[model samples]
Target: MIDILLVPIVLVIILVMLHSYFGMEILKRGIIFTDLAIAQFAALGSSISLGYFHEEHFYLLTLSFALFSAFLIAFASTRKLHLEAFIGILYVLGASGIMMVLSHSAEGMEHFKSLLASDILFTPPMEVAKSAVIYAFIAIALYFIYPKLSGFLKELLFFSLLAITVTSSVSLAGVFVVFVLLIAPPFVALSLNFKKPLLGSFIFGWFFSISAITISYFYDLPTGYSVVFLGAFLTALVVLAASKKALEN
Candidate 1:
């Protein structure tokens, strides 16, 4: 059991570490659904690839669509038009586009479902390592280069990195997992008024993710869905507790 869980635990930790910092930025910017929209576009691109190739590697195709989404959202962020509304439109377009692409495929529905929630238990070690390297590179760039960017360039760089992150994440962990990881931990940390929200988010995300993975292993639950449930549940509890405390105060 220990050996079986080792890889998944490592993967979740890495994912949370990479994503929590970005989540703080997203939350601060009030673009809550941006990652979901980008991830959905990536999934749509992958669906098209699946329709043609019957496989899901389609990284370049997915990255292309994700970057397209980033471009639109980054531009919209500066506009008077409602950014959330624009993101919602993109999300819906990606969803409908996916359905249209998978309409006639033999396993269309199954493929669609898988795109929403892949079986992370079967992820290849090579893929895991590759994602880790990609995430590390992004982290390094953010640390060294992000501060120097300004205005349009800053928005572009942030969204572009987010797009790349979502492209890889959606392909491996699926849309639900990516969205949950990108939002839940940060939400909880912020609500609790943590001194360092990013670090707080990473710790809480790791705790819930590892617990969920262990529970899934024991009970045969879907790992991705398990993580989603625990993340949401924990975050909701934090929000509620915070609200109650505020009311008392």
Candidate 2:
């Protein structure tokens, strides 16, 4: 059991560390669904690879689609159109595109499910390493380049980095997992009105992710779905607690 879970737990921790920071940024910017839209597009790309291309260069395809969507959103963010509404449209369009691509494949439903909720328990070590490297590079860029940007360039850099992160994450943890990881933990921390919300979010994300992985392993449940369930549960609990605190104040 220890051997079986060690890799996945480490992988989840790595993911949490990388995503929680970005999640805080997303929450602060009020573009809550941006990651979801990018992830869905990445998943759509994956579905296309499975359905038509026999999984050839699947990651590249996914990254391409995600980056394309990211650039579109970045450009749109500067436009007069409502940003959130445009993001919603992107999300829906990506989702519908997935269905259209999968409509005729024999493995359509299964592939679709995998795209939404991947089987992280069976994730390869090499994939984990590659993700770590990509995340590390993004982290470096954020540290060095993000602070120097202004106006539209800053927004573009942020979304582009988010797209790269989501591209790798969607392939491993699926869209729902990626969304939960990006939103729930940061939400929990921010709802509490923490001064250092990113740190709090990192802790919250780690706790839930570890707990979910353990519970799923013991019960033979799906790891990705388990994380989603636990994340939602924790988020709800935190929101209720925050609400109660607000009422008290």
Candidate 3:
């Protein structure tokens, strides 16, 4: 059982590291569902690849759609529009497009389920390793390159990097999993006013994700959805309780 779980454990650890940072940043930016919109667009691209092209050029299509979403968001960031509402519209647009594209395929529902969340218990170790390398590069960009930019270019780079992250993550985990991982940890940490929100986010993310994976294994639940449910559930409870305490103070 350890052998089976080892890879998933490592995967979640890496995911927590990369995703928590983005989650914190997204929370600060106040565009909460940006990752969701980008992820849905990425999934839309994959759906197109699967439906018509037999999944050919999967990564390219996924990245392209993700980048397109990033570009749109970046451009809109400069405007004085209702940013969250615009992002929500984009989210629905991508989602409906996905349904339209996959509506006729025999494996459409299964594909849709996987797009929402895949059983990461069966994920290939090599895939996790590849994503780690990609994430490492992204981390470098965040650390060194991101600080040096300004204005529109900075916004573009930020969302574009997010696009790249979500592009890979949506395929590796699923759309909802990506959204939760990007929101829950940081949301919980920020709600409680943690001094080091990123570290706090990491701890919370690991706790729930690992617990969910373990529970899923012991009970034969879907690992991906298990992670989603536990992570979201725990974070919601933490934030709500914390809010009530804050109100009392």
Highest TM-score: give the candidate number.
3
- What digit string (tens of lDDT, one per residue) describes model 2 on residues 115-146? 88887888888999999999999999999999
Q: How well is each residue in 53-74 modelled by candidate 3, as lDDT tens digits?
A: 9999999999999999999999
Against the unseen true structure, what C-alpha lDDT does each candidate score?
A: 0.89, 0.90, 0.94
Which RMSD values do the candidates have, in order?
Answer: 2.1, 2.1, 1.7
Deviation (Å) of 232 in candidate 1: 0.8
Which wins on lDDT, candidate 1 or candidate 2?
2
Candidate scoring better on lDDT of 1 and 3: 3
Q: What ordering of candidates by lDDT runs from best to worst?
A: 3, 2, 1
Lowest summed-lDDT stretch of 10 residues in model 3? 240-249
Better of 2 and 3 by lDDT: 3
| Candidate 2 clash figure, as a count | 0
User: Which residue runs does candidate 2 get wrong by more than 4 Å?
Assistant: 244-249
What ranking of all candidate models by TM-score puts the best one first?
Answer: 3, 2, 1
Residue 106, model 3: lDDT of 98
